[model samples]
Target: MRLRGRKGIRETIESQHDLVVLNPAEWKGRWAERFGNEKPIHVELGMGKGKFISEMSVLHPDCNFIGVDMYDELIRRASEKARAAAGREDGSAPDNLALALFNIERIADVFDEGELRRIYLNFSDPWPKKRHARRRLTHAGFVRQYVRLLDSRGEIHFKTDSRPLFEFSLNSFADLNIRLRRISLDLHKDGPAPDNVMTEYESKFYEQQMPIYRLEAVIGQEALAEHEASLALAERQP
Candidate 1:
């Protein structure tokens, strides 16, 4: 079933010069001088409905952004937002944003190694089952992917309300030798970071009196941690 709820879903995503690939096989090493803004690239993994990156891309004019998600329906909406951005008068102010339909597990293949300056891991699945811990985006397996695509100085900004997931991510960072910085177990206690991007799930979590946990981890090498359990829920089939 196609996920619904964007104003412009029917418009074409690709220009005459390129193809909007829906399959993961076509995604590897594709990013280049493709966007209008030539500055460093920032990306969001699991960009649901294009809310966070779309707003962030609009706000930050100088930096380019690419949002990667596996859902074709979601990318279609994200593409529409990019097409809308193309006509803006200011060049630095997000003349465009890019979208791709690919799995997060294929992070390195999605772009050339060390190509991304920053990554946003917003409300990724907790995968609560002990057996499924390996599937979490912050898990050792996923961290390896991030390590490959992220620049040496690049950081992964994460936000989640799940205590288990937060603890797991911190442990993953430590075990993997990933540099943990700007640590925040609670987002509301300290002043909200000016650059933080909020997703739809984040807003819902806020309204439910959940304490939002946020952190920044830089790429590094550390021993991987052992998973206590696997995700009990069925993985969302792509």
Candidate 2:
């Protein structure tokens, strides 16, 4: 599904080149140097319209954030809001933020192993078919990729409105032996968390009284070793 062709999305995103990296692969393993800081890097995979990442960068100047989405049109919209938020006449984003357009499957090519401190999966697509289970963002294969990309203490924060997907993800994490924390079955039953940054989809779901499920999972040394062993065992199955 392509976004309506905005007259100049390419130019708009390019004008914000300082904030949006059209070729993120060039900065792989050197993203911190590009940011000119050793601050921990956090990325929101599938960032739609950039609401959360833009607000988060403003709130936490000490940390660097990069929002990754495959869509350029959405990135253009995000760039506009980011530039406006920073009050920049030019289309640059906040100093602590960046945006990237890249294939999520090739995420490793854009970031080295252990280069990231945290990854956010906000309202990711739920590939509901049983055969498509591996395509789910929280599937064991993707979880393993995230494990390789994140530091030992790194965590993945996932939020979704789909109960079936959420339940499947919970099992996936357990199967991968990832440590789970901060489980919330209904994130907005009371109110948004103090530091909660809502995505565009989240806002719409909230208005419909949908229960949002969230959890934080981490892959430490033990978990990674277990993951590796599982892969080895799977190879031996044949």
In order, the Cα lDDT scores of the candidates are 0.70, 0.87
TM-score of each: 0.76, 0.89
Q: Taking the tens digit of each residue's C-alpha lDDT, what string does model 2 give over 137-218? A: 9998889989988886588999999999999999999998777777999999987766898888899988888899999886
All candidates: CA RMSD (Å): 10.4, 7.7
Candidate 2 local lDDT, residue 165: 99
Please give the range of 10 consecutive residues that has the lowest summed lDDT in model 1: 222-231
Predicted candidate 1 versus true structure: per-residue lDDT over 65-176, tens digit per residue: 8788887667776655554555455422244466767877776666778777788999988999999988899998888777787765567889998889999999988997
What TM-score does model 2 achieve against the real structure? 0.89
